[model samples]
Target: MNIDSITNGVVIDHITAGAGMRLYELLGLGELDCSVAIIKNVQSAKMGKKDIIKIDALIPIDFDVIGYVDPGATVNIIRDEKLVEKRTIDMPELLTGVIKCKNPRCITSVEQELDHVFRLTDRAGKVYRCIYCETKAG
Candidate 1:
């Protein structure tokens, strides 16, 4: 109810109501020493109900992971208490290290150092398949 405005940081907005925590963990915000806020199920006119993550620090974010998890999310950059930039997320065509191939036979599973790579196979359905074994990403 009384969330303080960030002086310089990013505000991740319009998260699909329950996906805030997933986004928070996936982004490795837990490793940071800065203040981070996860606001869930907030009333929204455009989205009906939404989740928001407010990072009280400016840091590099993996857009691919964010897009893959929640394509409808938005990122707002706040600088000096003013919104400086706003970004709308869309599904990524290619993803690397954003998700893992669940297939046990996938080369990535055997090669511990190999990056988990996936390509968009069905845009409308948001389907992605592993590049090595063609295993569908869950």
Candidate 2:
């Protein structure tokens, strides 16, 4: 309940409830040496229930990964214990290497070196189709 603030780091806020761990795993936060905290199911006036991730270091983050996981989330950059920048995430128009195409016959399956690419085809439905085979991304 008592989480300390970071002096210089990034905070991922307004995460959809129960999505903090998925974001953490996809972002590979566990591999970092800095302190990281994941707060789950925090009551929020706006979101009802949300999650937050605080990283105690300034590290490069792949926004595409965050968008893919939860586009409704926000990113806060803290410097000298003050918020320097606040970013509202949106669904990326294109995603590369963020998600693998589940289609077995896709080119990515045959060519291991090919990066899995998906383009957002339907923003309303949150649909992403593989660029190689036009297969819907799962």
Candidate 3:
């Protein structure tokens, strides 16, 4: 599907192919209930299979999701169909309440629906370690 562009809001680009839906959930976009355009399995020169999410409302980004998924993804804020804030997602120093720490022995598992916390161990390596159990994930 070809879209001209969103009149307002933000365009999240360079998303990992399958991670598009997860990104939406991780950021709680479902709760916002806004008009969102999710383009999956799009051809990309840089990334073999990429995705683009265009939200129709002006919503503040949840950077934690970006840090967990593709730290290199770019967030382009659009206003009146004009490029405004173009930011490349950077690996966060610490990640909390974002991704679930994959440690069974970790305290997060003991508590139900506990906010998962992690740390970006290697920015260059795209590695993350659980803050609770200190387990390396993704």
Candidate 4:
């Protein structure tokens, strides 16, 4: 309830209520050495309920991963305990290594060295298809 503000770090805000943990895992935040806080199910006027993630260290984050998990999320950069920049996430057109192709016959399954890639096929539906076998991502 009393989370301190970060001086130099990134804050991921407006995450879909239940999607924060998935985003956290996919982004590999658990592997970082810095302090990170995940606040879930916070009341939000706009979203009804939302999740927030605060990182206590400035580190490189793959925006594509955030976009893929929660396109409506926002990223805030803080420096000197002040907001330096704010970014609204959008679905990415291409995803590489963010998700693995599930198709058993897909080349990625056989060729372990190849990167699992997907392309946005339907923006309206947020459908992603594996580039290797055109298998729709689940």
Give RMSD to native, each candidate: 0.9, 0.9, 2.2, 0.7
In the range 1-138, model 1's lDDT, one tens digit per residue, is: 978889999999999999999999889899999999999999999999999999999998898889988999999999999999999988888998877899988788889999999999998888999999998888
lDDT of 4 by residue, 1-138 (tens): 989988999999999999999999999999999999999999999999999999999898899999888999999999999999999988999999999999998989999999998999998898999998999987
Q: Lowest-lDDT window of 10 residues in candidate 2?
A: 98-107
TM of each candidate vs. truth: 0.96, 0.96, 0.84, 0.97
Q: Write the per-residue lDDT of candidate 3 for residues 1-138, one digit (tens) a residue.
A: 676678889899999898899888788888877788889999999999998988988898987678668776789999988998898887788887776777789998889777877887877787889977789985
Which one wins on TM-score?
4
The segments of candidate 1 whose C-alpha lies over 4 angstroms from its true place after superposition are none
Candidate 2: residue pairs that collide = none
Q: On residues 1-138, what C-alpha lDDT tens digit does candidate 2 reach at each position?
A: 899989999999999999999999989999999999999999999999999999999999999989888999999999999999999988899999878898887878889999999999998888889999999887
- Superior candidate under TM-score, 1 versus 4: 4
Assess candidate 1 and give its TM-score to the true structure: 0.96
The ten-residue window of minimal lDDT in model 4 covers 60-69
C-alpha-based local distance difference test score of model 4:
0.93
Which pairs, if any, clash in model 1? Answer: none
